[model samples]
Target: MAEGFLTTHVLDTARGIPAQGVKITLYRISGMSHRKIAEAVTNADGRTDAPILPKGTFRPGTYELVFHAGDYLRASGQAGDGVLFLDEVPIRFGMAEDTHYHVPLLLSPFGYSTYRGS
Candidate 1:
């Protein structure tokens, strides 16, 4: 098996730019339990300086990426004073094989998208 790892990036679809300063949390979920495993904050390029789960640390299992987008939306002047429609976006997925998993977030004030990337 090839080395396995996990990474992520954030794109602001509405502004058409990288989303900086977005907080991300990784959770390892098993049955009814969710354990916090890692945390990262996006930099100027909307990417973590390092992989959230690096080689030798990554495993095939159920995971969740919680993107704190409300802070970014408010900081970018996109969110209104009322409650946000997309605040903490939780994307739950499974890594079935040992390879590379890039789960990116395409974010906007009202919605978001994510997928398995290269």
Candidate 2:
């Protein structure tokens, strides 16, 4: 695919593995209004089967990726009542046209981090 697209991957930092079957939701953000765009579950490689925002669909604006971390961890047998700190992890970023946006998340039950990738 060309440069103007949005993609993501998730890694389970604690288990040192790709976080499969994690529910991810994409949203277009406009001030206080959040509109859902798309939703997908991570595959075996912790990536969506297709780009979140394909080339023709990409636009310059703010977007959010909400990762259902707690549920994924619980399903993987990693999270418990008091041990889970993060549940729905939201990564918000601004995209520019004609540029590839790869937002990868390194996550644990208690903490997570993300960055803009090539």
TM-score of each: 0.96, 0.92
lDDT of 2 by residue, 1-118 (tens): 4458899999999999999999999999999999999899999999999998777787789999999998998999888766577889999999866788899999988789998887
- What would the C-alpha RMSD of candidate 1 be, to one decimal place? 1.4
lDDT value, candidate 1, whole model: 0.94
Ten residues in sequence with the least summed lDDT for candidate 2 = 77-86
What would the per-residue lDDT of candidate 1 be over residues 1-118, giving only the tens digit for each residue?
3489899999999999999999999999999999999999999999999999888887789999999999999999998778999999999999988998999999999889998999
Candidate 2, lDDT over the whole model: 0.90
- The regions of model 2 sitting more than 4 angstroms off are 1-3, 81-83
Against the true structure, candidate 2 reaches a TM-score of: 0.92
